[model samples]
Target: MRLLLVEDDTRLAEFLAQGLAEAGFVVDTVAEAGDAEAALDTVPYDLLILDLGLPDGDGMDLLARLRARGEMLPILVLTARGALADRVSGLNRGADDYVLKPCATEELVARAKALLRRPGGALGAVLILGNLRFDTLAMECAMENRPLDLSRRELAVLETLLRRAGRVVPKRVLEEKVYGFDDSVASNSIEVHISRLRRKLEAEGATVRVHTLRGIGYMLSEEK
Candidate 1:
């Protein structure tokens, strides 16, 4: 899943970013509310982990602005303010969940899972296409109950496609979601990943196909 982490503390931000990435999430982190707000304007994230104590502005303002714009994106408030009043205020301001600072990584992950399982969030870790099943939590893909070995990037691409199954996901979106903003993506890099993923799925006897929509993008659908 893709997530935006808005925290100003450089040490905590780096630690969380690395930890979240290792936990099978693509995280883009910014140190200030302004950059976070700008990122929200462009990127489509599955969830937002926001810190109320931002350097430039209060994270609550950003959350309120997002809600005012009618964006129902799932947001989790992660901050040091653990008082009952602070938690109540955060939820009242549109946060889906609130986690106190110095929280366990596992607890944070659990909360994220709970939020994503909500009605409108992305599908749970398991993605199904015909007889094929890809489990994001396990980082494994199975075809008809037989496990198919896949590399990390291959799994990432397939996960992206399967999450938005039947919808055309543009190459740029895939690049951003998979590699994040820091990596230098080549012109045909996405194509390479897509091609590799296609071969793996075909070899595994998956009944779904990844279709390229020419100049538009790619989609995953059951093979006819």
Candidate 2:
């Protein structure tokens, strides 16, 4: 899933970004509330992790603005304020969950999964494309009952495609989702990943296809 992490602390941002990426999320991070607001205007992220302490403006303002605009995207508030009143305020302001600072990475990931598991987020952790099935939680994919072992990056790419099955995901979108802001991605990095994924799927005897639209992007669909 794609996530936007709005945090002002550089160290915490880096740590969370790395951990979340390993946990199979495409994470984009912005340190200031302005950038966070701007990012939300452009990208449609699956979830958001917002820190109340921002350099530019209050994170609460950003959350209020998003809620006022009728954006129902899931948001998790991460902050140093652990008081009960603070948690209640955050929830009342539209945050789906609140995580206090010094929180365990595993706890954060678990909360994120629970948020996505809600109705209308995405189907269960298992993604389906034709006869191919992939379990996101287990990081397993199978074709006609045969198991396919895939690298972490390959798994990340495949999950992105499967999540949006039949939709043309733009190359830039895929890059932002997978690499986030920490990695310097080559121009052909996405294509290379897709190529590798296609080979792995085909090798497993799956008839599903990953179609490239040349200048457009890519889509996954059943072979005709």
The lDDT of model 2 is 0.86
lDDT of 2 by residue, 2-80 (tens): 7899998999988998888778787898999889878888877889999998888888889998999999999999999
Please list all clashing residue pairs in model 1, or write none if there are none.
none
Q: By TM-score, who's the top model here?
A: 1
Tens digit of per-residue lDDT, candidate 1, span 1-224:
78899999989988888888777788898988899988888888889999999889899888888888988889999999988998898899899999999988878887887898889887576788899888867678899889887766677788888888999999887887787766677899989988988897888788999999999999999986
* Clash totals, every prediction: 0, 0
* TM-scores of all candidate predictions against the true structure: 0.92, 0.89
lDDT of candidates 1 onward, in order: 0.86, 0.86
TM-score attained by model 1: 0.92
Error of 1 at 9 (Å): 1.1
Residue 32 in candidate 1 has what lDDT? 88
The ten-residue window of minimal lDDT in model 2 covers 174-183
Clashes of 1: 0
